[model samples]
Target: MNINLTLIGQSITFLAFVWFCWRFVWPPLLGVMQEREQKIASGLEEAERASKDLELARRKAAEQLKEAKEQAAEIIDGANKRANQIIEEAKNAAEAEGDRLKAAAKAEIEQEVNRAKEQLRSRVATLAVAGAEKILSVNIDAQAHDDLIEKLAAEL
Candidate 1:
């Protein structure tokens, strides 16, 4: 065998193999690689979008939470104010009731005192008529002497 012929044959075989791969095999392989690269790029873009959406959702949730807290604080403050108003109203009502009771008690006391004074005046007039009758040695008719007793009670 000649060395140059062997070298030439191997060179031609290598060229033929490279040409075959380029024409029949490389196209499908390149296409598959391009499809894989597009899928990867789309997946990366979708991941980035999902991450942004998650961030937006988190921010929105935080804002809502803050608003809820503010609303709750307002509600609590309103409740406190209402409670204070209710308490003040109750206190005012109680005070008014106390004043009314005191006035009623004062009126009742005055009525009782006036009743006692009338009774005492009647008793004193009766006693004075009895003493006058005893001193004059005459029995007094109360119904006939009613006007004198009235005058005497008035004087006392």
Candidate 2:
């Protein structure tokens, strides 16, 4: 073929190839690229939203942990207070019981001392009366003895 003829055919073929690309290849390729770009943008937005939600969940968990610690401290404090109160009450009751026992023992000791004193007085009085009767027995007539005995009995 001649150089000029070959050049003409090449020009026609290039034009036809460009026309085919514009009509069929370029439109679908551009559409697919746009769709891929939209998908990537939506994915990035979803990831940002998920990150925010995760941050919120972490904050809530931290708050719950703080609340749990406070509650545990409150419970421990309450138990300690109750135990102290119970111990104080027990001490008071023990003191009261000791006082009552001491009072009762003192009363019993006093009663025993009084009883012993009464018995000694009765024994001494009986001995004195018998000694006076023996000493005065020979000096008295019958009527006088009777009168003296009546007097002594009255004195006793």
Candidate 3:
């Protein structure tokens, strides 16, 4: 091809090309690329922060689990001690009550036996006097009957 080289035409073409690139291509394209790069950088930073937060949460959970285990052990120990104390106190109280009941029953039985013996003695004395009177066909004197009752009571 034959060369067509002119300074003015070359300068005009270069100016038009530069104008087109500045107006239609360079501004929006460079702006979009820069915005995309900034967004990627922000996303990477957010991911790193989230990872740190997760580690912190895991550590806090481990501490809470340990504290909970200690509290549970203390509660169980306290319950066991309280149960033992209650059992001991109950046993002592039951023994005391049994002893008191046993003593009361023994006293009542002794009193009842004494009362029965007294009643039987009185009845036997009355029957013996009645038989003696029937056999003799005579009424006994009051003073003699009283003396006989006294003797029988003393012997019993």
Per-model TM-score on C-alpha atoms: 0.73, 0.60, 0.70
Could you tell me how far off, in angstroms, the CA of residue 4 lies in candidate 3 after the best superposition? 7.3
lDDT of 3 by residue, 22-93 (tens): 999999999999999999999999999999999999999999999999999999999999999999999999
Ranking by TM-score: 1, 3, 2
Give the alpha-carbon lDDT of every model.
0.90, 0.85, 0.88
Report residue 150 deviation for candidate 1 (angstroms).
14
lDDT digits (tens) for residues 32-135 of candidate 2: 99999999999999999999999999999999999999999999999999999999999999999999999999999888888876776576567656755675
Name every residue pair that clashes in candidate 1: none
Question: Tens digits of per-residue lDDT for model 1 on 1-156?
Answer: 657888989999999999999999999999999999999999999999999999999999999999999999999999999999999999999999999999999999999999988898778867876766874577567676777667776777
Q: List the residue pairs that clash in candidate 2.
A: none
Question: Best TM-score goes to which candidate?
Answer: 1
Cα-based lDDT at residue 23, candidate 2: 100
What's the alpha carbon RMSD for model 2? 6.6
- Over 4 Å off, model 1: 1-24, 138-156
What TM-score does candidate 3 reach? 0.70
Which scores greater on lDDT, model 1 or model 2? 1
